[model samples]
Target: MASFTTPDGVTLAYDDIAPAGEAERTVLLLHGFASNRSEGWRRTGWYGAFERRRMRVIGLDQRGHGESAKLYDPADYTREKLAGDALALMDHLGVRRCDLFGYSMGTRTALQAAILAPDRFSNLILGGVGGRLLEPSTDRGSIMADAMLAEDPATITHPFLRSFRQFADEQGEDRRALAAFVQAQNPPLDEAAMAALPMPVLVVAGQRDEGAGDPEDLARVFPLGKGVSLPGCDHFSAIPHGLTKATVFDFLDGLLDDPFEGRF
Candidate 1:
């Protein structure tokens, strides 16, 4: 793993694995909220799958997560700030363009990045995201933030919200940093801007993932978008599932057969 200081002075940790091929295809990975690059992508079979495909893979541990610098200020985690860091990493690595993959919180960052600079991206893959991206995220952030900072995990009665606290505890994440991030205010998603993007996008979600809503709805918003649903999976299970990896691989290889291909 290597570290670089962003223009804003936050240090981020990342891994760059290059494939032994002429094409030198590149893909950038952004992990979910409480996850690091190793746990979110490497241990989840993503690294091996991309290696087998001979694609150059770059994964970043976003600010306040993994080995990256932790900041207790909510303002430090705004959508624009996270997006700036992502773009900065690309520039720091001298990567003009690459395929991008992100999940959950990562999805939000990826979306803002693509919107900010569509020309620097080829294909955009959003996992564990759906129509919820179109809604206001302020409430969601506050709810998760409260759950993360709760004095006792047992007090978080909502099963879905409680899961985050439990996962953070299990991962030994910095609760104060995670709490600030979970409650950070990100600019509401701009669907109009998203629809104008020229790159082909794949929105993938689990069939049982209620938090994501319908991937097809989000997919339709993009001019060149497609949605795929993985059976027998939920939000967390969707990311590391074999089916999820296969679907992502198929889409990346241009072998995907979307269920709602032309409807969009």
Candidate 2:
């Protein structure tokens, strides 16, 4: 376990998992909203898998989540700021470049990081997200904020909102702080930004994930992107699903062999 202070002075917690032998590559894993690195990667068996493949793993607890400093101000959770924290973590460890993996809300941060520092990342693996990244949609953030702020989860009629509230309660998250974080979410990345990504990209999502929109559609926007589906899985279930791991690893293996090969 280690910690680093962001430029804004918030201390973020992270874990660096080394390979058993010499490392072939490095990967940075980012978790979703109200989730930490442990539950996101370590608990899902990602750390072990990466280590087995001789890949160094770096996982971080984004601000207001896990062991990181929690702030109630919405201003503290901007997309750019969150992305900056990831880059800062890399700089702290003297990592020049790495493969980036992000899920759900973390995917937005990953995309922003790639956009801001295009040369710092070699490949991008985005899970639990899809075409929603290309256009604006309903304010799910506000709905989630309201859900987290609700006095009673059962009182929230919206099914998704209720589910999020229950999940947050289970995680023992600071509801107020998470609410602020949700409210601070920036707008989705535009078409131009998505098209500008020059590195090989993989977009994966559950077959039944309505929240993710359409993975295939999202992949088409990227010049060097491909989409994979996790059969018989939903948004939450897809994260730890075996199919997700297989698809991601296969995509990563292809990148390792030939980074320029765009087709999967």
Candidate 3:
């Protein structure tokens, strides 16, 4: 239940888990939208897996989610601001460098953080995201916001929106705050920024996820990146899938063995 105040004065909640043995490395876990650290990482068995690898894990509840300070204004949840919160947490913990494993919405934050401070990360594992990283797409924020505001989930017409509302309700999340968060849309990271990344990266997505786009195509954009597609999984289902974990662990293990194994 530890917490830190961002420069913007938002109090973000986080959990710091020590490695099972002498710490070999540190990993920062970023959860997706409308999801917290516990549900996204801890309950998904991510914390234990990392612990088994002797990696210290730091999972944070992004602003307006989980036990952190919730703001009603959409302007407060920008990508830069969210990224800053993560970097600030690292500084607060005195961790000079670490690896980043971000899923879905969290992937955007991690990418922005890496762009903001490339030297701060050794490797990056981007999961549940793909081709959307390259091109600008329709903003679904309003739809999601509308879904959150809906009085009855059954009344929501759009299947995507309705599903999100149902998940939020099931999780008992703060709908108003999440609605505001949706309003605070993240700016596109663009290909130029990703292509220039110097650290090793792995792009992962479910083969059947429409939102994920083409992971192989997305990976090609990064100078030092590779892609892995999990079979029979969608964006939501991919997060907790065994294949996703295996791919990430394999990529991370490779990094541990030789940080520049595949680099020219």
Better of 1 and 2 by TM-score: 1
Q: For residues 1-264, what per-residue lDDT tens digits would candidate 1 score against the true structure?
A: 699999999999999888776545889999998888988999898988888888888999999998899999999999889989999999999999999999988988999999999999999999998887787655777788889889989999999989888888877888889989987765668889999999989999999999898998899999989888877799999999988887787787788876435534
State which candidate, 1 or 3, has the greater lDDT: 1
- Candidate 2, superposed: residue stretches over 4 Å from native: 255-264
lDDT on C-alpha atoms for all candidate structures: 0.89, 0.87, 0.87
Candidate 2 local lDDT, 106-162, one digit each (tens): 998998999999899999989998886677657778888888998877799988678
Best-to-worst order by TM-score is: 1, 2, 3
What's the distance in Å from true for residue 100, model 2? 0.1
Number of the top-ranking candidate, with lDDT as the measure: 1
Error of 3 at 146 (Å): 0.5
TM-score of each: 0.95, 0.94, 0.93
Candidate that scores best on TM-score: 1
Q: What value of lDDT does candidate 3 attain over all alpha carbons?
A: 0.87
lDDT of model number 2? 0.87
True-structure lDDT of candidate 1: 0.89
Off by over 4 Å in 3: 255-264
TM-score of 3: 0.93
The residue pairs found clashing in candidate 3 are none
Worst 10 residues of 3 by lDDT: 255-264
